[model samples]
Target: MYFCLFPTWHSKVFRNDVIFIYDKYFFNLWFDLYLKYFFLTSELIILISSLWV
Candidate 1:
C-alpha cells in the first residue's frame, strides 16, 4: 500500500492514520528515477544556455 512518506506536510484532519504507515519502497523507486535523469536534464539546460549566450 502507498502512503505519504511525509505526513506532517499534509492536513492533519485528512491524514487517515490507517494508510500512513511508513514505507521506503516508493521513495527508493522515485529517487532512482530522479538520479537516472538528473544529469541528462542538467546537461540539456547547460547546452541550451550556451546556445542562447
Candidate 2:
C-alpha cells in the first residue's frame, strides 16, 4: 500500500537528517508493522470479498 511504503521512503530520503538518525530504530519497527498490517488487511479484504460472492 502507498500509505505503508510512503513513510519508509520518506525516512530513507531523510536518513541524513539529525532527527531521522535519532529515530532510525523507530522507523524500522514502524516499517515492519506497516508491512504486516498492509498484508493482513489485503488478505482480510480478499477473504471477505470471496465470502460475499
Candidate 3:
C-alpha cells in the first residue's frame, strides 16, 4: 500500500520543489554557456588586435 504524509499539500509542495530544482540547474547551465562564449569572443578580439599591432 502507498501512503502520503501530506496528502493535501503534497502535490503543491512537490511541484514547487521540482520547479526550484529545475531553475537552479538551468541557471547554472546558462551561466556556464555565457562564460564560455564570453571567453571565446575575448580570445578572438585579442588575436585580431594583436595582428593589427
Candidate 4:
C-alpha cells in the first residue's frame, strides 16, 4: 500500500519538470521517507525510555 502511493506521488512531482531532473527528485522521495521514519522511530524510543525511567 505504501509503495503504491509513492509512484503516484512521484509522478505528480515529475509532471512539472524535465525527465532527468524529475527522476532524481522522484528518487529522493524515498530518502525523504527514510528520514521521516527514522526521526519518528527515534522520537518514539526516547519517549518510551523517559516513561520507563
Task: List ranges where model 3 is wrong by over 4 Å.
Answer: 1-15
6-32 in candidate 2: lDDT tens per residue?
A: 545655666667656546666678878
Find the candidate with the highest lDDT and give its number: 2
Estimate TM-scores for all models. 0.45, 0.58, 0.69, 0.56
Query: 3, model 4: CA deviation in Å?
Result: 12
Steric collisions counted per model: 0, 0, 0, 0
Q: Give the per-residue lDDT digits (tens) of candidate 4, residues 1-53.
A: 65434544555655755654665665678679889999999999999999999
The per-residue C-alpha lDDT of model 2 at residue 13 equals 69
Which lDDT values do the candidates have, in the order given? Answer: 0.60, 0.72, 0.66, 0.71
List, residue by residue over 1-53, the lDDT tens digit for candidate 3. 11122233433456777765665666667678889999999999999999999
lDDT of 2 at 2: 58
Give the per-residue Cα lDDT of candidate 2 at 29: 80
Q: For candidate 4, what is the total of clashing residue pairs? A: 0
Judge candidate 1 at residue 24 and give its lDDT.
Answer: 42
Which runs in model 1 stand beyond 4 Å of their true positions?
1-22
Q: Sort every candidate by lDDT, greatest first.
A: 2, 4, 3, 1
Backbone collision tally, model 2: 0
Error of 2 at 25 (Å): 0.8
Candidate 4 scores a C-alpha RMSD against the true structure in Å of 5.6
